[model samples]
Target chain A: MTAEDKILPKPLVSVRGLRKFYPAGRRFPWLRSKPPILALDGFDMDIFPGKIHALIGPNGAGKTTLLKILWNLIQPDEGLIESNHLADDDTVLVSGEERGFYYRLNGWANLVFFGRLSGNSRQETLSRATQLAERLRLSGILNRRYQTYSSGERQKLAILRALLQAPRLMMIDDLAKGLDPQATRELTDILLELARDGMSILLATHRLDLAAQMCDTITLIHRGKNIATGSPQKLSQQVFPHRHYRIVLSGDEVTARKILAGSITSDIEIKDGHLSAELVVSDEEELAKLSLTLAQNGISIIELSSLEEELETVYNHLLQDSDSNDG
Target chain B: MAAFFIRDLQIWVSYRLSLFLDIVGLVGTALAFFLLGLAFEGYIPPMLEQYGGYFPFVIIGIAFFGFQSNGLYGLSGSLREEQLQGTLEPMLSSRITPLSLSLATNTFSFLRTLVRAVLFLVLGALVFSVDLSSMNIPSAIVVLALSLPPFLALGMLSGAFTLAFKRGDPVRLVYGGLSVLLSGLYFPYQLLPQPLQWLAHAFPLTHALSGLRAALLNGASFSEVSTQIIWLLGMGVVLLPLGIVALKLGHRKARRDGSYAQY
Candidate 1:
């Protein structure tokens, strides 16, 4: 492990055996009992300080439920959530719901009100709010009523309000819900910068691509149960044992296909002067052996590229596996 | 609390047309009562003879009823509004305690009601020549002060209903309607039938209005108005804890249902 990894602080928040259930449908006199919807069933997570931990799942996967539980906005039916800063002013939740702010008040007034409630002095709140507004590129519209802001701008202001608290742990739900591409990129950059500056973030989102790209750790949840937790690369590796490689050959495709057929057990397809092959190699050594074998067969490799396993594919594969297991 | 107050004030000020219309409505109501008072000048009830006019008696009733309605309705309405706007969860997530939140939600409405009470009194004295020179102002203030807690407790109860059920807080409507009909806001409770008078006594507003009118119109001292004060205080003592407990339970139920943020 790198020195930087070794010195990382302990978890700012740890959740264990967390369970929450909501009653399904309306109660009727004739009905004996209403079934409960399992929102979070034995969900576990450890969010380290200074790390951006992404809680990623599909809709109805309980990402927002978990966030609300952590924020203390909702109580879990059964769980042990240990957060170092749970009751401290240093923890803040930025919900994706658009109605948090007072619509009649301007962005600055809303920020100031929330900031003071979170324990900042009046002067300090104003100063921090100004700084955050400017950082989020929201200074230009801070004076406008919150109802007048576009969805993206409103979201930016929400993020700014959370930032104004200068929280030690910031819980963000669906951080990119209504943002434009540019704003999403800007928010991603801001989160990364905050993480670098030692802010622990619990980001709940369904945007797997962004989670893979930006999060230090990704926790995949399905049906309110944690499926896997690791770095994006590690998760990808866990899901996909075999790696796919696409090779463009300068020589004849027939010869390249023939050369790969003997060495690789997986299927090989030749298309448009390229040979696609899957190799179940555990390490680079095995891959190198495969490459040497192809070279020895008098085939020159023109351009070889490994088709990296993507977060989307891994997520789908995990969910499908879980489904089949349940079946 | 200050932050909440400032935020509410800013929002209230932003709706200038609503603010203006509110004042206009209050003035219009006073004007209607003035005309009615003139017609009934010769028919003043014996109970209201000490006050010298139906206008003074009714005006005091209206002012105190204003306080009760604003406290109870405002609390629940504000909570429901927050839930509909999706801000309840966020506000609850803040460092403020539940009781503090309850009080903070009513801050604007209570202040606005106080302003309207003053305006009503001024209009009554100036336009209708309702006498206030003989009012035991200190005793009246004490009675008003003592009357606040019970109404606040009722407000909290209504807020709890809104928190749990999202809509259809029966207490708000029942209390509002009953206070108007039985509590003698428009007339004296003596006019109601025997059994209904007993029912009226159950409401804190009945005692509060009686105490306010006694202190303000009849120049009653602390001892004279002490019975009503004692009843209001007793209700507050019993209901305050009940209200807090109910609100806490309702909050927990909402959280368990995962419907705290749902309107």
Candidate 2:
């Protein structure tokens, strides 16, 4: 990268070396003295403009803390955060739980309240709230108390409040947890629309399928650190190289085993009168040769599918790699 | 800051009627005591000479204390409830400073308190015919108004303590205990023992009550109550800064511990 390129205003949010800690013995009231839980330790990432980035990790992976830091809700202990772009423009950030809405107030009042908090005048908030209500398809129930709204409806309202400010950068944290399929789809569509209109979004979610479908890039975090950042397919291939391919064959078990065993270079397991094997094929030629060899052995191939969507596999692989290195 | 305050005032206005009812309950309770004072008006002239001058003083005292107590309680309660719902951090993330935010949050409750004080005084005057047009009335009002900052400062200091300590009930435990026994709410300060009298005098409320009684009931002139006015002013000056400093320090400590939003 050139000096001009480095100095260019490109990324909307840049973070480095973030740290947070809490007293570990806090949960045990009886323990008067103990070390604290290091909730976030040296988290680092940069989110660029106009790109939909997905942050994926396990339960204690510091996703929430990262989002909180990025939104300036909580400052990191030791790090640099550069968000000059958002400083100049209205940015919408929403947590998985609807945090900003008032339960006692009706939906419109809560929206307006938050709208005004974001520096909008009362008239502006009221007008923009109506528009947001219509956009979120919540116009009919705007006057109802927020507590009366269904969980999904409340989440949608929260999302609408976030968008009501006409944000340039939107941060969503683990938003796909409790939503049904239809709500998830609707949310995805709305997110796609926002991204298409040149709004940069950073979404933290555990659902790999959603990330795979929506995010243009993926940043995987494990234990408060970024383990991988690249395209979804690239990360998947890098993490799990020899895709776990399931082969179904209809033939004499002994013959099939003999034919498969001859070509396989690694492990093999037989179950339910079927043969499952892990083969090491380095190139297209080897794959073709193995298939041809099976065909010649009179083994009718019933199915051939690769296991790629199992997120646990990818997570465990990354975690094991980090654990081994630490050990 | 003022804008944030007004916004909070608007939210309070939305619930104005319910809040008014709560204030009414407070005033009604205070008026109950004033009625008790009226019961002995015939046989207790000597006692009345010393304390009868404090009837209106009692009325204002209860009304103002209720306003202060409930205002702080409601503001802190609302904040804690928001923390439960996960709104505290987000609201804090906004540009408004916590002082300004607090002022805004407590605006309605304070206004409600002021309005209730007026209503209670009117009801006390009509039923008991207590004279408040004495020369001391202005000084008493000034004392009450001046004492507001220190009182609010104490509330803010307690709020900060709550934020930092996470589970200390010092605000309620201390304020409730003192308000009942030492705030001069139910009786005059001289009725208590010498040590207790000194303890009561230490509080801002005591100075306010003394100044108000001297002005409204005893018909004392402003010059006559110069010492009490100085005491009230000194309390405001000393405690307000201390409270602000404590609040700022508590905020920093909580943030450093990564527990500022725990509530």
Best by TM-score: 1
lDDT of the candidates, in the order given: 0.83, 0.71
**Which regions of candidate 1 fall more than 4 Å away from where they truly are?**
A1-9, A29-31, A84-87, A247-259, A263-282, A293-304, B41-44
Q: In model 2, which residue pairs have backbone atoms overlapping below 3 Å?
A: A24-A36, A24-A37, B136-B215
Model 2, A151-176: lDDT tens digits are 67877887888787787788888776
TM-score for each prediction?
0.92, 0.82
Candidate 2, B94-212: lDDT as tens digits: 66566775566666667667777677767767766766555355766776777777677777777677767766658756875786678676667677799998888777777766676
Tens digits of lDDT, candidate 1, A75-144: 7989898877555667788877677888998988988888787778889988888887777788999899
Query: Model 2 chain B — which ten-residue stretch has the worst lDDT?
Result: B43-52
- Provide the TM-score of chain A alone for each candidate, in the order shown: 0.84, 0.75
Which has the greatest lDDT?
1
